[model samples]
Target chain A: MKARGGVDWMVVVSRLVFSGVFVWAGWGKLRDPLAFADSVAAFRMLPHPVFVSLVALGVPVLEWMTAVLLWVPRWHRAARWVMTGLFALFAVALSVAQVRGLEIDCGCFGSGEPTKWSVPLAWGRAVGLLGWAIWYGWRVRGRSADQ
Target chain B: MREGLREEGLRMAVMVAGSLVLGAVVNGVRSDSVPWEYEPKAQRMSRELARVGIKEGETREVAAGAIELGEFAGMVREKSVLVIDARAPLFYRMGHVAGAINLPREGFASFLERSGLLGKDKSRAVVVYCQSETCEDSRMVAESLRRVGFTSVRVFREGWRRWLESGEPVEKPS
Candidate 1:
């Protein structure tokens, strides 16, 4: 395959790091679905029934799939988009919870007491990840003919 | 070049669709009210315990929310029930449930054992209360009791503050 615009090394590094983090988080939740449910309930975003159901099943699958797709060469670009979208969703949810003064755990890492969201941290992570995705997409578009 | 762009667009569309579908399916399955396998039976037991004002091993039963000052005075005449205040040591020292032993949340585990309270005749009713309904310290202590084979464990959800506010009998800290 042709090299894409001299290879965006920063994008590559970000993808790997984010993918690893997702994998680690997903695996921990997979080990204890009930605990994750409790964490989700603490957020108070949805009804208990709906929240419990999602955390018990949907969360782990999404996390694992996103993590796996990140490393696969064929799925790299698509995975980056999906991961970026997911993180963006998370940032939005956290922002709303903070504004509402809902002291619930982020549920990003299973069950625990509710933690305060750091706005700066959330923005930094979101921007960095989304930037990598955009860079990778731009590179691929420019080098399409060679590939 | 046009062909390459078209292919890439198609690929992106497919990937997006796949992710959305997966998310929907997972959320759909989870939104159902089915109980998960990992949630311990202790949750149900706690609910039940809260409903009835009787401890796990004790024979005497008090009305739920009967921990008011007047009620505590009337209820404790026989010394059949043990009202355990499950607040922090500092809070307990300031004042607690009248005649209630101070079982601070942190010291409860060993206190139950060392104080000979754990295996004491199950007939002695144990009423565990904490700061209030939102405080989980009492529920946790009650759950611990059940796990240790204590038959009766009642959580006084109203906790010490309610008991004090009700103007029940209270002894100042010595």
Candidate 2:
């Protein structure tokens, strides 16, 4: 397909990558709610266990929505932006956990495996995703002008 | 094209806001259904650990030089003490405190009931330990025990690693 205004191959590739990540993550959490709740508890930020459980349940829903929306051309830009914002939050949480020397799992994939927290790597990924969102926004804006 | 862009932006805003509101409402309702228990930070963990103590008939806590292996062996002979190895099952099967029952942190609830360990006398001491001091599995298992009304639960804060490191007795799986 001809690139829609500024929505070039890079944007499409970024969207696909993020969609796959979210779908895999969402499926993992959805398979085991209690495990996800335990992972959330490890963060120690949510003062209430009930709130942690709620977040555990809601996270998969959000991931699934972002994954599905990324594939739908009409919602791709919005999904990209949302996913970028969420990843930014993840980066912050992971950085704080590392700084505190917490041995808790990142819960990124909901597998309860401890992951190395690399702030630079996380920020780089966020920037790439954010770039895609901006490009898609520009493309959508250009397409609207033609209409 | 400009109009299309404006419409998409408006729709995106409305959708994002609507989803956020819906999420908040659902979470609020869910939170109302359960009791709120908080997980303390590492600093809090240290504070909590300092407050833990043992009373009579409790075999859970050990001094730095105490032999956990001997303790487990003695408990096994008594048949009164319940020893739960809170490490992952694979690790538990590889080696553990002698007579320690494997109850990996993830499946502890079911393991407790299936092992016929639950609803036992609250005063009866239960010892739970994972890999080491840094490991959170033991803490999780201890918390699970508390949730089920086990009043005499104790965590072997320095777990199997320290147990073996201290030249304490350990046994290969049968």
Best model per lDDT: 2
Clashing residue pairs, backbone N/CA/C < 3 A, model 1: A53-B30, A105-A114, B55-B152, B55-B153, B56-B151, B56-B152, B56-B153, B57-B151, B57-B152, B69-B168
* Residue lDDT tens for model 1, B1-174: 778556646755765556445645654465322253323324533443443332453222223422344544565665667777767666778887667776653435556656576556765567788776555667666655555556666777777667767776666778
Give each prediction's root-mean-square deviation over alpha carbons. Answer: 11.3, 8.0
Best candidate (score: DockQ): 2
Model 2: fnat (fraction of native contacts)? 0.10
> Which residues of candidate 1, in runs, are more than 4 Å off?
A1-7, A116-147, B1-119, B122-174
Supply the TM-score for candidate 2. Answer: 0.56
lDDT of 1: 0.59
Q: Write the per-residue lDDT of candidate 1 for residues A1-147, one digit (tens) a residue.
A: 324676556556655777787887777665556556665555466654654554456666677787777667666655556676777767776666667776565656654433344434544566665676566666554332113
Q: TM-score for every candidate vs. truth?
A: 0.50, 0.56
Alpha carbon deviation, residue B159, candidate 1 (Å): 17
- Candidates' chain B TM-scores in the order shown: 0.55, 0.54
Q: What are the lDDT scores of the predictions, listed in order?
A: 0.59, 0.62
* Candidate 2 runs further than 4 Å off: A1-9, A41-54, A98-103, A115-147, B1-83, B87-110, B118-127, B131-133, B140-174
